[model samples]
Target: MAKTVIVYFSGYGHTRRIAELAAQAAAADLVEISAEGEVSEAGWSQLDAAQAIIFGTPTYMASPPWQFKKFADATSKKWFTRAWQDKVFGGFTNSASLNGDKQVTLISLQTLASQHGGIWVSLGLAPANTKAATRADVNNLGGSVGALVQSPADASSDEIPPGDLETVKLYAARVADVAKRLHG
Candidate 1:
């Protein structure tokens, strides 16, 4: 099996739940990007050793949280060394509004991966766009670039809808499968 690492910074907690489910599904190590915008040397070691790295962050102002950006900025050393080149990369994001510009966050992650010369892995599932598509349906958000989810503004971390998590698990599985095939 390919070694996988999930690095995430959850502002409220909804994003943390998604990251946890993704880590569980992928059988990957979970590294929390601190709100203080710092990661231990061990965290960098895990990222360097992993075959896959998945990013998770909340969508704030149509982009990733500031801490996540700080985390990305901190990777300049690895980027300069091309240490993560060719590693499989994937990402996920969540927001309060149904159309809360989550795509911007996903794109930011992809761009960061690109800077590291990593291969970006996308969510391969088709959009569940049928008339019967429910809020609990998989890929209902029509996110192809990455996992995108909507949580109610007032909902707590425990109140995250199941459908969003199901999609996150499935997407992480896809990334793990591809990494296994490529690096196992």
Candidate 2:
């Protein structure tokens, strides 16, 4: 099997919860960017050795927090050397509102992957947009670029919508499959 790593920053544990689910479903490693935006040397090594890298972050004010951006900036060395080139990449983002401009964050992650010359993976799941669809149904957010999750502002990390959680897991599996086919 190909090695897959999920690198993420979570402000209030919500993104971390989603990352955990992704990692569980994909059997991937987890590397958390600290609150100060720093990744340990071991984490860097894990990223260097992984065949697939998944990005995760919470959307704040319509964009990823500065910590994740800082982590992205720190990857310039890898970007310049094409270290991540040809690898499979996937991303996920969560926000407090149904349409909290999560796409902006997702696109940012996709662009970051492109900068690294990685192959980007789409959500690959149809939307659960039927009139009868409920929050428990998978792909309720109708995302195609990546996994999109919405946790109400008042909800705890444990209170996220099940559909969103399922979406991330399925997306992670899709990414893992692609990476294994290409790199395993």
Candidate 3:
């Protein structure tokens, strides 16, 4: 099987929900990046074995959370070894504001993946910019480098927008498909 891992840091559970959905869709294992910096040895092994790595983070001040940055920094050893070179790399993010500078977050992620010599994947779905677009829209067109989920500040986990969830599922499937094709 083409192994895939979803590594993410969620602050308020919104991004966590999206990450879970992506993992489920891709049939991939999940790894939560915590502020305590606790990552299982087995998880690191799994990451090394995986064909694809998906990153999810909540937009903090128009960028990724510091915890996620810490985790990324810790990957330098892997980078030096070219461990992730040519692997499929995808990213997703959730933000409170509708236009919470999500592109900035994706740009940061893409830059990091580039440093590792990884292949970055975009959200593949089309933008939800047309007048026909509704809450039930499927693709999240014109989004950032990867999946982009917009949740209202007051919305609860159960209240996540369906459009965003659909976009994430589609993005995950695309990543899995790409990994399968490239690694098979």
Candidate 4:
């Protein structure tokens, strides 16, 4: 069976919640990218073995955190060898504000996947932006490039907005489904 993994860097706890939820929803393994120190070699091996990789990180200054960038940069060797070629890729980002330039982070992730010659996947669920939509709705932010989540800067991991997390779960499922379809 094809393996799916969630490789993420969470400066704050909010993005970690989304990553955990995504892993649970997809029945995927989780690999947390470290900022304070080196990432485990096992993590790299897991990523190398995965058929689908979901990148998660918080949006900082309208882009991914420098820690995540460092991790990306470290993959230069893999990039040159096309180790990730033909793999499925997806991403999710969270921020303090509703319109926190999250798209930029997703775009960056897409570019990273492209550089690795991987396929990029988007959240396929319909956006629940209708006036009648409630906080319980899915795809509330209308994120197309990737899963977009809103996490108040002051909120704890458990306090993540239910709607945004739901969006993550749905996106996770979609990515897993696509990978399965392709690999099977």
Candidate 5:
């Protein structure tokens, strides 16, 4: 089986929920980057063995959370060693505002992956741009790469839109499939 690891930071539990769903869809291991900077040594090993790495974070001031950035910063040795070279990478994000500059967060993630020489994967699903698009639409628009999950501030856990969840699941599955093809 292709080993995969999802490293994420969630401030309001919304992003964590999204990450858990994606991990379940990918059938991959999970690693949470906490504010206190805690990650298991075994988790690091799992990450080294992983063929794909999926990240989740909430948009903080139009960028990823400081904890996520700290986690990335702590990987400088791996980055210098090119540990993630050719590995697959995908990510999802949640924001309170409809136009919460989520794209900026995605761009930051893509830039980090590129620095690690990783292979990036997009959602590969069409946007819901037409007038016929509905809440039940499989893939909503605006995300050009990976999955962009939107959750309103007042939305409850059970209120997460099906479309965003489906998008995340599809993206995770695609990343896993690609990793298997590349590493198997």
Candidate 6:
């Protein structure tokens, strides 16, 4: 099977929880980008070795946090060397509002993967936007480009909607499956 790795930046632990769930579901390695926008050398090595890479981050002001941007910038070396060429990639984003312009964040992540010559994975789940759908239903947010999670502003990290958590697990599994098929 192809190895998968999740590299994420969590501002207030919410995104961290999602990354943990994703890593567990996909049996992937977890690498956290520090608050200072730095990833350890080991983390970079893991990314370089993985057949699949997933990015998780909180949507800040309709985009990823500056720390994620920093990490993306630092990957320029990998980009120039074609180290990540043909790798499978996926991403997820979280925010406080139900419609927090999360698509912008997803696009940014997709663009990053494209720039790295990676194959991007979509959420691949149908939205549960019907009248009776609730937080417990998968794809409650109707996201397609990537997983989208919404946590209320006042809620703790654990308070992220169950549907979103499930979405992350499913998406991670999908990315892993694709990587295994393509790279193994």
Per-candidate clashes come to 0, 0, 3, 0, 0, 0
lDDT of 4 by residue, 1-184 (tens): 6689999999978888899999999989999988752468999999999999999999999999988998899888899899999999999999999889999999999999999999999888888978898766888888999999998888888887788999999899889888888886
51-76: candidate 5 lDDT, tens digit per residue? 99998899978999778888889878
TM-score of each: 0.98, 0.99, 0.95, 0.97, 0.95, 0.99
- lDDT score of residue 122 within candidate 5: 85
Per-residue lDDT for 139-170 in model 1, tens only? 98999999998889899988777778899999
Comparing 3 and 4 on TM-score, the stronger one: 4
lDDT of 2 by residue, 99-181 (tens): 99999999999999999999999999999999999999999999999999999988999999999999999999999999999
> Of the candidates shown, which would achieve the greatest lDDT relative to the real structure?
6
- Name the regions of candidate 6 deviating beyond 4 angstroms: none
lDDT of 5 at 176: 93
Residue-level lDDT of model 3, residues 1-184, one tens digit each, is 6888999998888988999999999998999887665567877888899999998999989999888998899899899999999999999988988779988998999889899999998887768788878866765436857988888899997788898898998899899889999997
Q: Write the per-residue lDDT of candidate 6 for residues 1-184, one digit (tens) a residue.
A: 8999999999999999999999999999999999999999999999999999999999999999999999999999999999999999999999999989999999999999999999999999999989999999999999999999999989999889999999999999999999999999
Where does candidate 5 stray beyond 4 Å?
Answer: none
What are the per-model C-alpha RMSD values against the true structure?
0.8, 0.5, 1.3, 1.0, 1.2, 0.5
- Can you tell me which runs of candidate 3 are displaced by over 4 Å? none
The lDDT per prediction is 0.91, 0.96, 0.87, 0.90, 0.85, 0.97
As for candidate 3, its clashing pairs are 126-141, 127-141, 127-142
Best of the two (1, 3) by lDDT: 1
Native RMSD of candidate 3 (Å): 1.3
Better of 1 and 4 by lDDT: 1
**Candidate 2 lDDT:** 0.96
